[model samples]
Target: MFHPQQEQGQPSCRQNTEETDTDSDESEYNKAPDAPLTPHNMQTMLRKATTDIKSHLASELDKRLSGIKEDIESLTSRTNHMEARIKELTTSSQAHSQDSTYLHAKIEAMEESLEDLNNRSQRNNIQIRGLPEAVTMEGLHNVLKGLFKSILPEASAQDLLLYRAHRALRPQGHNGPPAFLRN
Candidate 1:
């Protein structure tokens, strides 16, 4: 059953299919029956594609710009908060510094007053010896007042003020001297 078309030493099926495809392509290429494929039509399509691409890119750029603005705003607020905190810390330190200076001055004044008080208290105190220990211990305050009256005679025993009275320790390794009462 060899066909006549196959006997001609040609690519039988391929040649037939190529001829059919080429005939259909030639008919499809002349799609616009009334108008021709012109440069203006191509330019119009190119412009439309360019406009669509530009619009898409503009929207993407706007989205990125808004995100960047949000990030910048967040950073700005954080920076403002840090600055406020730093200012608060600086103010607190300044106040503390002033308080420290005032406290130091108060402490120095207190020290001076304490020293003056010690000197005045010492002035009112008396150390006496040669009195019999028994007689001194019986009523040391009365005995001292009487002795002061006998010695001074200008001030009364009632006028003397005795804030404190005590027996103080003697110097170390000096045991030969007679014991004395210190007030």
Candidate 2:
């Protein structure tokens, strides 16, 4: 239904025949025969159009601001989650580094102990190899007793032999003697 404010002969209050004709003429003028728009001029026009469009969009799409805000909030939450994950990973990496350092120290200590054991075993083996195969256990004990008495008068013969036997069984490797001996 046309309101009284509408111009005579027009069907709707918002429609104006003169305005429509003017818009049509302007559109035709925009397409007039001339040099094609240059890139620099087109870019300037595009920038101006974008600025106007953004201004119009800001005014017309005000109702969508709340939705945009919600989207921003979700993105922020995801970013926060990623930061927390990175922190967790960093902490775990540090802990793993500490664990690795401790394990390395333990391995070094074990290696030193094994080296000492190997040296002692080698000395005992040299001593045993020097002895005569015909030497009886009793003769061996007496020999050790005399040796200990000469060097360490305070040590007993039994104690000296026992120490020598312990030295002979000293470890020979990092893990132990070998798979056969370990088993």
Candidate 3:
């Protein structure tokens, strides 16, 4: 065959070039002929690399799973704490409600007792209206004593005793005279 590497007037030495290329290629492999790449070696390297990759992936997965587990445990603990707090608050609120109810009932009872005591204190007391402003305390007392004596002749002086006689604290109006209270 006509070769491109040959000079136009020179003959092609194809056989000699082929022999040189073969010798150089053999010299390179002759140095380590026992360690030549083969299917068995490639299969062993592939298996080792696959096992290493699997081990790495498993380790990463374990780390992530442990971290997730820790996070779940932390969340569970917080949830439990919150539940306990809610229960405590509920109990406290119930107790406070009971206390408020008790206080309200006691206050109402005290108010009723106060009203009853006021009515009882004023039951026997007398209010004399239309009394003239000119009536003195001593004069009103004497008039009441005489009136009581006339009304109850069998009563003793001690029974007709007047505790106090006084006029109303309000200013006298033009429509009516001042009133007196005798107790």
Candidate 4:
């Protein structure tokens, strides 16, 4: 039998009963007032909560891990640069050390050459001792000429050449005897 409300496009008593039954069934499964707390419902809720937490934790861990990976890469790059710099410095230091050694050897050779030259130049020089400090340059020249004539009487005046003659430098009252340098 068709009702008047059903003919006017409104819900009839049978449709209302079916709608209420569907709503009550849905509310039983998804927490509702007067719905009994069954183990199945609790398990379903716990599974959903765990799934959400797992997804959140996974996302957080991924973000943190990506950041850590970037930091590690940056540190690795810096370490590589530092290692390269250290290598460069070590190479430069080794080169400088070699140069320093070469220069030191060259300097020693030059010093020996200078000492040999000095010895050769001073070989012809002579030192005259026991000479009075008050002897003048003219007096020293005359005395040396007379002594050379006596020592080599056959030698001419040209062979007896006196380059320079000077008194030894010292205090007025020193313990040492007087001396003269003849060159």
lDDT of candidates 1 onward, in order: 0.67, 0.61, 0.73, 0.73
Superior by TM-score: candidate 2 or candidate 3? 3
Question: TM-scores, in order shown?
Answer: 0.47, 0.37, 0.51, 0.68
What is the Cα-based TM-score of model 2? Answer: 0.37
List CA RMSD, all candidates. 13.2, 16.1, 13.0, 12.3
User: Candidate 2 overall Cα lDDT vs. reference?
Assistant: 0.61
* Model 1 lDDT per residue over 76-167, tens place: 99999999999999999999999999999999999999999999978856787555545535487777776777678888556776665555
The global Cα lDDT (0 to 1) of model 4 is 0.73
Please provide, for model 4 over 1-183, each residue's C-alpha lDDT reduced to its tens digit, 9 standing for 90 to 100. 333335566555456545555435445666664456543345445556787899999999999999999999999999999999999999999999999999999999999999999999889877765665566777988877876787699999998898887777855545444333343
Badly placed stretches (over 4 Å) of model 3 are: 1-53, 131-160, 166-171, 176-183
Give me the candidate number with maximum TM-score: 4
Better of 1 and 4 by TM-score: 4
Q: List where candidate 2 sits over 4 angstroms from the true fold.
A: 1-59, 127-183
* Global Cα lDDT for candidate 1: 0.67
